[model samples]
Target: MAEALADKNRYAHAPRNADWTIDQDWASYTPEEHDRWNRLFARQARVLPGRACDAFLAAKQKLELSRAGIPDFAELSERLARLTGWRVVPVAGLIPDDAFFDHLANRRFPAGAFIRPERELDYLSEPDVFHDVFGHVPLLADPVYAEFLEAYGKGGQRALRRGQLHNLARLYWYTVEFGLLATPAGLRIFGAGILSSPGESVFSLEDSSPNRIAFDLERIMRTKYIISDYQQTYFVVESFEQLLAECYQDFGALYDDLRAQPDIEAHALCAGDRVLTQGDQHYFRARGMAAE
Candidate 1:
């Protein structure tokens, strides 16, 4: 009981409700905090126009996310709901996986209420208001992408029941966080993690250091990912509709098959992979994590 009480207190902000949501309290942000937001916004703004997906860019413009300062959830929600029936809700920080899946399942995006410190603007270890709102919120305005997310939310429980949540998590990580999209114009960014980071915005598309593989449900589930730094590989989707159709299914059979197969290392490519770029692996070699 004592430990449970202690864990609950760790939230430490925003007076959380049952859903683990807290008030954004837009008024509480300081001038310095808003300045950090603008700086982060400005960096991504310069890089995104040529790199980010047409769909994501269109939705971002439609939602008017380019304006100054941290967005007020109340105002952002009003605009987003009008477009796709989805709304952004503020969270104290990282909520439980169940709560996260539940929020997405119900069309509520649980964004971190606080902004990252000024010192860590270049790289924040956890998802902050900028990463959540700037990286993710715009895609929520796209109908096809938005529907895919909701479907992913609804399918979470079955994976949990099968004890294959890790596999399911890879789906989100590969697609939503680090995904790339192939366009007639060329490969464009869609994943929030890539779209938001100024450094990676160029690396994921132009650096030729990471494997850009075509999206495959089984392959992504079997593969590992990097969190602390850039991905050694990125999966590219043909379209949001293609991703939705691929994932919208009973995965019991897939789970059974995957349980018997070995997990792939983060940077390794398979013989069967539809490789777009084989990746020189120059970056990982410099770090001594990849050889051959």
Candidate 2:
């Protein structure tokens, strides 16, 4: 059953366009596909209120995401453009690193054109339209985050030229995908990956199993992250402005400094880390013991 399911979800080749883009064909989505999207959205919606950052929740309503069904890219683009000059573009699947950076640099978010299968709703290897559009798009409405993404995109192009894409990717993994915010109400989620996953939504904040360390640019850049599991350590920033300020500068020198340093394990804590929550790592240890 697992083998057959894997085969069904496998991609033989990249989708249509030369640039890896395709028309969203908003009308072509079948009822089943839309239903899958609704299920994913509804599950996240129920758990996100106090957990998700204020910005995400505000934008969700602004974009009318809570209304019904999958949103049309054209309509979403119009709303996003009006807010922050950002727009959503449809892609077949993952695009090349350079191409991905190029899109962000221009304020164009390249989203996968498909939705996850109903059977694989909880886990999928690659991000689908629901993940791309729903998890990420609303945040793009905020001006600070919008500018930060464009800067990260531009910075990514330079990283590729410098052979520092790996380091740069770590920054994105920790911040854009799995970052947390220290808000007035306490720690809140701004990262798309955490906000999109119902299970992680609770585990990230409530679970006593993962480290919640303060965000440090160099610390995050040198850290390794898990691809197939929840992050063992999540970096927390005080504000979006702070995040933007830290990332706006040229990383050329920092990248040079990083090349000499050994990479930090995903869950390792350094002496200078501002320990927000020193997790017991119960989940991680359990997984390890099971593997053994």
Candidate 3:
């Protein structure tokens, strides 16, 4: 797991502080860097209207995110605070789990301070400023989702103490990173990991290669997830309020009960799942056959 994390964060800039934070130095960004942000923003913006959840789209407009270039964290925080009491803080890269949880618990989001290079435009192992800001900041504008994040952070801290961090991490993965929302129109994306990537953004909603299941708290905590590729399944919530209500409960006993059960594979669907869309497994199966 440590090695996997290292590989995942190989591209992240090293931090100058113990807590993995650094000054954003918004003034120091080169024109090319700003151009990269603009290009990535424009690409995702064009696709998000129909693809992103209504809450996310509304938040994006409310935040006025199309101002071009990377956002100033100070300015972004000011605007976000006004809307939802959330603040965006600059981080050198991915920090320790405890530190991350602490930040979220305090209503502060630790965003990467650098942008991805042009050569790595389509893909990056580590989240850059574009992914952090463009993907995550918009959603922070929603009051319910913002509260859910804080609850998640507090839950994370408790989970860490109970040796249930893995379970909590899975919840984070399937929700904040790759969660979906079911609306009257159809399934929409609320996950930052899916929202930021042009390919995954489309593939998550339109493709027939991944499972779309209703958000079951225990089921999600028990399910495993993949980091190197697109998700095999996405847990969908009815609304941000639903997500918050589900997570706000006491997890102490739940964590104790979960420790006795075996983990479910990323691609395996358990019986009694409020299954929405059954996936073909085309993507993973093809990859497996290629490996064989």
Candidate 4:
């Protein structure tokens, strides 16, 4: 941790403020970077139509994210603030957890100022501006989801104080980053992790290899997550209101109990789970086979 804080290279692209925000310096992005953004945008455009939730698609259009290459944070935030009192701010990269919770708590979404290099276009563990803005910022326009995220942000601060950040992160991982939604048309992608990925954009909805289960607050907190590959399971929320209602629950006791319980494997199914699809786990099985 000490070494990380002292690393000068981390802050090379943008000067970090006390709060860890940096000016997006929108004009500084090169033509090549802009072209990459366009290429990524076009890729998702082909897959997201029937896959992304209604709110996300609508917000994407309203924000006019496809108008150009990379969007200027100032302009994007201005429009977002009008709709849901949320603002998009630029960060050097990943900020400390406390700072991140603070930003979300205050309706400020801290996006990475950098875009991934051309070689890493297909997938990246570290979020880039495209993932932050293209994947997350759109949903900030939905009033209910906006309220839920702010509440989650405030909850994060409390979770940190209670030494429950690990548990809290699963909720975020399952829902915020890789969540799905149950719709009449079928399951749709809502997670920025999926919305921004050309591969996940299709696999998440169409593939039969991952478990799809209904969203349960306690269950989500109990489950482990995969960081390096597509998830072994996906949680589906009924609606934004359904998701927002989860924020109203008292998590103090929940956290305490969870500390005493063992974590559920990412691919394990519990008795109470409302199974949407019983994934064959073929993806993981195939990977295991290939490794051997």
Query: What's the lDDT for all of these models?
Result: 0.89, 0.88, 0.87, 0.88
- Evaluated against the true structure, the overall lDDT of model 3 is 0.87
The weakest ten consecutive residues by lDDT in model 3 span: 4-13
Clashing pairs in 3: none
Which ranges in model 3 have alpha carbons more than 4 Å from their true place? Answer: 1-18, 289-292
Between candidates 2 and 3, name the one with more favorable TM-score: 2
Q: Write the per-residue lDDT of candidate 4 for residues 1-292, one digit (tens) a residue.
A: 6554334223344568999998777887789889989999988899899999999999998888993889999998999999999999999789999999999999999998788877678877788888999999999999999999999899999999998999999999999999999899999999999999988888888888888999999999999888888888999999989999986666998998898889998888999999999888888888772111
Q: In model 2, what is the error at residue 142, expressed in angstroms?
A: 0.2
lDDT of 3 at 145: 94
lDDT of 3 by residue, 195-291 (tens): 9999999989998988899999999999988888888889999999999999998898889889898999888888999889989889878888211
lDDT for position 84 in model 2: 95
Which residue runs does candidate 2 get wrong by more than 4 Å?
A: 1-15, 289-292
Candidate 2 TM-score, true structure as reference: 0.94
Model 3 clash tally, residue pairs: 0
Where in model 1 is the C-alpha error above 4 Å?
1-11
